[model samples]
Target chain A: MMTLAHTKYIVLAALIFCLTPIFSQAEGLIADQKFKADNEIFVTFSGAVDRAVAENIANYTVFEEPDPDIQLELESATLSEDSTRVSLRFKEPLNTAMTHVVSIRGLAGIDKTTFTVSKSYLGYLFGILISALLINNFVFTKYLGLCVFFGTSKKKETAKGMGVVFTLVMVVSALMSWFFYNFILIPYDLNFLQIVVFIGLVSLTVQAVDTVLRKVNPILFNSFGVFLVLVIANCVIIAVPLILANNNYNVFETFMLALGAGGGFLLALYLMSSVSERMQLAKIPPTFKGLPIAFIVAGQFAMAFLGFSGLQIF
Target chain B: MANDKSSMQLITRGILSENPIFKLALSMCPAVGISTTVMNGIMLGIAVLFVQVFSSVTISLFKNLIHPRIRIPTYTLTIATWVTVIDLVLAAYMPEAYAKMGIFVKLIVAFAIITMRLEMFACKESVNDSFWDGLGMGLGFMVGMVVIGFVRELLGSGMILGYDVLGFKPLLFFILPSAGFFVVGLMMAFFNWIEVYYKRSKGLK
Candidate 1:
């Protein structure tokens, strides 16, 4: 009986060893390589890259001319055990060929890490939808643009108009933030000025959007622009890009985050407006008449959204 | 601007008549964001209280010196300076709290409560009145935050002050931002109900 047990134990150990690699292999690492210019490539190996190859590649760069516009700043670089993947960062965009070279390196004994130049259009769309409704939820997560959110949301029709305007403003603001951050700020190495720059951008964007909308479509713009100015200085627009920057999400992810934040703002506004409309008729006490009740309602809504915290749908 | 009674009245006004979050509906920014937990609410309240009192006192003392045309700019500068000081202190001493609070600390500059009080009361009132008004409003805001924080933390985590008070599992919905609105609304309704009951029983006014 003792000998039989020993044999079973050995078989179990063998099975565990065999199964471990299969499970580990199922989740392949992704190596992302970005080309900023003709001479510079930013390589990030997510899963596993060969340590020797990564070191060799770094040494080769020392002898080579540095690519203009692609100032390599190693944000973080890591190599997994077994020398399967490597990740690196560059300050600027790289040309496509370097990315392809990194991809080939993965195939050469390193674990295969897929590198796609651009995310699918459908992926972008889906990401936008999800981001608008969930991930970087504006009202819930950022507490931005609340003045307009609470102010115009007192009535349903006004709330609807404000919601549309807020979303448009957010999209415009996000695009502006992206342009400023990527084109000017990052290039100039003025990332520390992000807060001031983004806030100014948001204020300018709101004013520009207001002016354009008013001229192009007066009726619609009138409905929305009333609250647009109010939300211009609000932090939601700038906060979205700040979050995207921290997460280091690609353009697709940034778009999604914008969508989620916008959607979340609209959701909060709609809910608050509907409740406030109902609340208008409710017999509230003199002391707790207007703002007090609104505060309480806002608190309750915030609590309700807490349910979505652990949801890993993203 | 008046005697002790008026000064005392100005102070009391913020606690009820001009309560920042509840009565006046100002400074909803930090109120909603940090009211997720009781601890956050308390910390934020104390921070705001400190800033408000000191800023109000400063504004009142320097009110005559500030130009009328540039009063808004000067007020903003003053508030920003105070906020920056708070920000630095928090960054140095309470790094964890500072990390969690994030940009909201800097946002104190734009918080309508501090600015509104500075413009409306501090600029016009005596130093003592301004100080009391700031304290009252700060306390009122604190009460608002604590109420929301208590409900959110309790229902969301099945705990109060981080202690599991109820054996029952928490309703996760109570912790999200949406729930912040709901909890605040329900609490307001409760407060309203209590006030109504008292008024009806006493036939007051």
Candidate 2:
């Protein structure tokens, strides 16, 4: 445990070392930015500019900061209907729950002037942990990682094995995706390639895990078997990291999220498998015998999980 | 080549015979995630339909170029590219509905159904056949989502597509995830019951 903690910090330091230069120039002088509930973030400048200039200002936001917590990424900018405001649309919707602080203080908007808007919303760390595990379980709530959960869920042993494997794989993959995304993708200006890169990273990691397990412990390797290959497409494996990177979790918070999500997946899978295994005895209709029945069972499990919605520890 | 009847058959098959979610159980993730509301289900269905049709046709168009050994990766890469582009384009261009679908739209990349179609039908089949199959399967998925979404929305919230027809919450559990499972299960059973009745009425079984 001590060694693990040490290595994490070591890695974090190395990552920050690589990322420092990327943030050197863009000290985010908040200027001429306005937020809209719809995906557009419109920046009104005092004067009008051509499309090319508007595009450049929007593109600059892409590499401005490497904060993983920043929810929105500027996909492109276009002139609004009035042709006065440069409407900046993001890759993802900005989280309305939090206030956005645009740091581009010195950077010029269409107005070619500097202005700032800041709102502080405190994110209690513990709140995130509880939320990830119970309220927003990747499996039960979000329905991610359902393929493997259903495919391997028929039998208790396979379900248990996949659960454990998934948990371990999710934690490691989350960290790896976070590291590469923050250090490499942001600095190198390949932010748009995130989905492809993250999926690739997950598949590669699964392959690596297979090879290591085969050499280290043959017992575990055979037990994991084809499910390892299946993990590549499991929504939770890629989605967790995607969620983490999008939320811009710090190392510790990301780790907690991984642990929470993994635990949630395991819990949901285990509960479903155990109950379904027993449910085989119940009399049922012919068409609903297999997959349809499983869906219903899953809905029941989801209701049980909904009970956790009020668990606001933070 | 087969007649026009075959194409109609292909399209209808997706709606019932080999329905992706209910019968085959290929991609249940989206079924459960977006089915909480009828609008969400419809929106996601349209998105999947667009992605599925394009992916199916693209794979068939480039079937020869993609090496058999690396086909899975190639197919995935293709799907990923389309999904990313669509996700961004929708978010930028259509802000309101885009906000509703959010990341669930991008999650289309991981859908086992799209990838399954590429491997099972798109690669071996001709362009026309693959196109029809993609349409059928995509339609099947969309219908399945709408059914589940409609059931959940009506009972869970006592509303359909944001309108409160029920005037009060029905079961509340019906809309929840657990209820989603039961609702899907019942629908599957209901469909199955229809199949049996149809066959019996025709003196087939």
- Candidate 2 residues A88-166, lDDT tens each? 6777765433334442223344344333322211234456667888899888788788878878888788788888888
iRMSD of prediction 2: 1.6
Tens digit per residue, CA lDDT, model 1, A8-78: 99998986775454233222444444333343444554444456655444332211123334334434444
The TM-score of candidate 1 is 0.63
Question: What's the true lDDT of residue B35 in model 2?
Answer: 83
Tens-digit per-residue lDDT, B14-124, candidate 1: 766666765566677776676778878777887888889989999999989988987765676676567667767787899988787877766665576787788888898
Measured against the native two-chain assembly using Cα atoms, what DockQ does each of the candidate structures obtain, in the order listed?
A: 0.19, 0.44
Task: Quote each prediction's TM-score.
Answer: 0.63, 0.73
Q: What are the Cα lDDT values of the candidates?
A: 0.67, 0.76
